[model samples]
Target: MGREIYFGQQELTLKLTGITRFFAIRRKVTMPYSTIKEVLVSDFEAPKWMIRAPGTSIAPLNIYEGSFNYGDEWYFLSFERKEPVVIITLEGHSKYRYVVFAMDNPTKTAAEIRRHLHEVV
Candidate 1:
């Protein structure tokens, strides 16, 4: 429904399943641990003027999925509601500078990501 986050030996993965994959126009995004700069859980609001180059957005329902661009920065977002989501800030990434997504347990997810990052470093 939302997305699944997986921690691999050298990378972290975000997999969009079911209808989310269709809306996102993407199945999965993988980034090496070195690229992950920070992870946080917060009530993030998608910018009002973001350009959806190849994504789906339903403003009334607050559903946003796929790639977005704003102020010359690339963002990959997959969230269905106005709630707390995990925001992963990345550096040295080829494409996305930020990956924002909603999860069933955003706090736990963020903690796990932090643990993984610590282990990788």
Candidate 2:
């Protein structure tokens, strides 16, 4: 019941409850491990040109939620810091081509996801 990514038995679940979802501008997302194609973690400073529509985007505060078009692909971004974030590339009939989420420990989160992905493969 804490604010952490839950790697479920069949899918990856990100919990977004209470005020965190509104301020953070994100909803709880669950994606099957089978859909994951790649996972990358890196330091990300919010870009000035990220247009948020139909989705939430508060660039000045470094808070982005919802979906944005980038590189001709739609990405789901949920974060509020200029620190390490995990970018997950997904395939198949998923809602987004990529998903970006900030983690307290991006490196650890990425590793956990990678481990689960490998097990599924």
Candidate 3:
């Protein structure tokens, strides 16, 4: 197994294991960097349906979820897979409604977790 990489909150210390085959994921939904603005961060939790995404079919999702409020912004973390499947959820208000920035881009280095936050925040 390769070194674990994450796309969500570091305080949660979420880790993924079966990403040995992760490089094959498509490009539209995969990248090394992205960014969302005016994130709400809270409100959305780890959705149960995510276990069905592109990842291990036998192991249940081990994503960790948490939320923190900063000023009027709420930051939510749905710690999805560690490599091939970490869920980085960024909540933001769009057109006067709440939206979840769930278009996560894998392939990032382990040291690039901050870039993930930048993609979502």
Per-model TM against the reference: 0.96, 0.80, 0.24
Worst 10 residues of 3 by lDDT: 94-103
Whole-model alpha-carbon lDDT for candidate 3: 0.33
After superposition of all CA atoms, the RMSD between model 3 and the true structure is: 11.5
Q: In model 2, which regions exceed 4 Å deviation?
A: 1-3, 24-26, 45-51
Q: Candidate 3: list runs displaced more than 4 Å.
A: 1-19, 22-29, 32-46, 51-53, 59-87, 90-121
Where's the lowest-lDDT run of ten residues in candidate 1?
Answer: 1-10
lDDT of 3 by residue, 1-121 (tens): 3323334442212332334234212111222233332323232343443323232322255443333343444433333454343334433322111122222443333225545555555
Flag clash pairs in model 2: none
Report backbone clashes per prediction.
0, 0, 13
Residue 90, model 2, lDDT = 90
Tens-digit lDDT track for model 2 on 1-121?
Answer: 1236887888988777655577545667778888888899986665566556446676777767666876556677777776778988898736777788887788888998898888877
Q: If ranked by lDDT, best first, what sequence of candidates would result?
A: 1, 2, 3
Q: What is the C-alpha RMSD of each candidate to the true structure, in Å?
A: 0.9, 2.6, 11.5
Q: What is the lDDT of residue 30 in candidate 2?
A: 78
